[model samples]
Target: MGERLVADLIVERLQAWGVQRIFGYSGDGINTVLGALRRSGTPRFVQARHEENAAFMAVGHAKYTGEVGVVLSTQGPGAVHLLNGLYDAKLDSVPVVAIIGQQSRTVLGSAYMQEVDLLNLTRDVASSFRQQVNSPEQLPLVLDRAFKAALADRAPAVVIIPHDIQQAPAPELEQEHGVLTTAPVWSPPTLVPAPADLERAAALINDGGKVALLVGQGARGARGQVRELAEKIGAGITTSLMGKPYVDESHPLAAGVMGHLGTSASGFVLGECDTLVIIGSNDPWTEFYPPPGAARAVQIDIDAAAIGNRYPVEAAVTGDAAATLEALLPLLEPRPESAWRTSVEEAVQRWHRLAAERAATPARPVNPELAVRELSDRLPSNAQVAVDVGSIVYWYARQLRLPEGVPAHLSSTLASMGCSIPYGLAAKLADPARPVVALTGDGAMQMAGLSELITVSRLWPRWTDPRFVVLVLHNNELAEVTWEQREMEGDPRFDQSQALPDFSFARYAELLGLQGILVDDPAKIGAAWNAALDADRPVLIEVLADPDVPLLPPFPAGEEKGGTMMDALRKEGRDTQHARDLLETYLRQEEGLNRGL
Candidate 1:
């Protein structure tokens, strides 16, 4: 009230950019900025359990809402804690702006308490744009540039402000010589390839007898165009994990996600296709793509550099996916329904049967596949989903059928664990009217999900519709990495490193004043989902999943790796018979698929 400080100006600028909320934890270095945010009361501040979780929430907000997410933190440890989430944004190509606090200017190179070199620390994660705010006059330019860079590059940007600068008086811009005032202004550009490039791409597509499309997150806006393109060319579509939400999995030609965590149907489509069209996806699994010269590829991406990064491309169309596809559709000659289309559809049906069989298979208590598959039917049409890393991702990818327009996001490129709860929190905060479902494994829940549940307990009552449901697959093991060691290293699961301590996830949820349902029976899985969705408050459904379920890759690749896995299991010495049997079951299923039985 006395005079506007630099912190006040910073908050005002954020509001001008239409930021409704800022996620962070309070710290001494950032106390002044926190005070300004409290005083203005325009941009609400959501306190997170940890700086890492707060950063994940920021990334989640950007992913779900298509807006620039903002996060704040104090010096040293708080800043270091933000690295994982910031890297998640960087690897997944999300827009996030991190505003970090530094020690007072007087501390200089004295290495004062909590005074760390944040600029150097964040060099790689925020390589798109990183700067230290030295003066009040430079604050506006830095803030505006950070937002612009984040939006433009679809990456995280950093702005480090010293404690002294945050407390300084706001500067007045009156035709100043050494000061620059920047407004937060940006607009999406309409990018389409030239007519010649479009013609070439279309000609290549028309020439191929068997065509396939590999879609990624960047093609999210062009779902209709993608479907139309596939229909016109009689093509099968397989999505990168990040692109799964954009395409309708219910489509007959939809082959499901492509990669190790992908479906057998996707493996079939990618393996058989003669022409590959990569759209807006720079998926890292190049080995899963049509082998070397087996297919002629055309890549479409907004970022030109990413076009040929993953696979060799014959036609590199540097343009926005929706705009490029819209233009190219006119040039494409529709192909009549052919035998190739029939084969693709047949593969898809086979995968459906295989998945259902796997999900229904009996386990000691509950099959993790069944736990996730049950949610596919009960998931509301208006729900938003957040998936965590680990074995749970495999079930979510294979068993869950997301209705069109229901966005499901995760740490795909980074493959970072401990992200689901924070991501769900961000999605819920954006539009509390829409219910959110978060799926996580016990390993991730132990790392960060449990702490964030307390945040949910404190905030859920304020939501308009309290239908935030958390699904914890309590397998009591790091199942994904356990299988990784067997398949990759041909080594048994080491109890010292792979086993997790026992914890009561559901009871803990109840202690926090939320509804908790513990299900060890497969029959109760559907009912648990129903109750959670219908609950008046946030609910956590903990399922006692079996660790013996194999995390096998999709066939041919999976079948080839079977011998190595069998060797590792045999080395487990004892009590691994169930796991070996499960592995044999999956191998037989793949063999049947190969024989067309």
Candidate 2:
């Protein structure tokens, strides 16, 4: 501590940027930065069980808090382990900064241990900003730029600091020609489309009879504007998975999430609409959209490129969702409640009834739909939700009714398994007073959740409200993949790849000194949820769910996929009769709904 080192400078710069914590794991390569963090003792350091999970926690931090999440790791294998989570941030457009430690510069070409060309390895994921610090004088410049680029692009950025550079003496920038000083500073711009563009969009909306709005995560801040516009124009509102939390699903006109794992109401709205308004969303499921020329379209987005990316937009308003809607609202004339509006509401009501019926359907041990839907009413108003990828997401999207203002996030675009626990940890750490509930499937539990539970056990004692509840769908099947193979490839379930080894998730939580509740009886699902939500410590609720429940997409698309699933199941012979029966039951129900729609 004689004089501040470059590592100390790095810590000071992070504090200046308002970073309160760094998610990472320890290794010899990064010992210097670890020492600096220990000595300075400003930003807390969170150590995960592995480097991969550490990276996931950082991405989760960014997603939950809307801040530039910082993660540190030693180079080589540790850096390699970070790729998946870094890609999750890149795909979801979350801002994260990964600082990696490299081998000493003196051993540049000597093939030293734990030496990775991290700059090259991370180039794709951190294409927005990827830099390596070569000198102590370069640390500040690189660090500031990484944060700025991450904010500007809303993407992950990478900074690789060699061990020698990290331990080098901190340099002072002065009135020197070659030296530069930088501060951690950046802010979002107030962006709105031109008046003429807004007027054009308004005209299109006013002209259309059966209008539908497709909202995405970009419209998060414009919820009020979206509701007002929907009211003024008498339009139905549907959200992409990423936009689910932003729009109140409880709204009468709310059609729920749209796309493969979407609701029947959404399918009807998108299928039958004559006019579509794409608002701050470039949802990738183009097939679910209205057929080409089936609708007149208007698009609004901050990024000009995304305006026309999904659908054919006759009017493009390149601006922020809230601001653009404000300008466009005044030019619109309110449409009186009509048959189209009535139809939309009817569809939404029908979906609600259908969801409840589906949830109550009996299964082998428990119905996942029923298990997750139980949380709808039981969830606290101040709770935050994290859902892992798999069949569980379909249940979350279709059955769960999140309270207004409650935020639920998942690795949607990346569709990565094992993200829920990390995301839940980040959300809980951000606001310990609020309850956190994570919904994950058994496959994901084994992939990453098991190890992360240790992290949860270690941290729960420090939480003000120890109400972190994790609901695991313990079906002993890779249910999503099993269905995907049948639907996509028309292949029978290859038990080797589609089945999972069993593990006692609830008992494991008990071993870790946390509360554990196992529910196999469908009748006990609600009681289990109540106990876990009100528990004094972190709780893991393991539900013995049935894997036979179909992962069918919304109808029309579901029709073809259902046919493929039937063929595959038929090929499985009489041994798979139960699954075949379940599929047929769902298909019949969907066909009836389709006829009504």
- The CA lDDT of each predicted structure is 0.94, 0.91
Q: In candidate 2, which residue ranges exceed 4 Å CA deviation?
A: none
TM-score of each: 0.99, 0.98
**Which pairs in model 1 have colliding backbones?**
none
Q: Write the per-residue lDDT of candidate 2 for residues 11-36, one digit (tens) a residue.
A: 99999999999999998889999999
Question: Candidate 1: where are CA atoms >4 Å away?
Answer: none
- How much is the lDDT of residue 289 in candidate 1? 94
Q: What is the lDDT of residue 483 in candidate 1?
A: 95
For TM-score, the strongest prediction is 1
Candidate 2 vs. truth: CA RMSD?
1.1
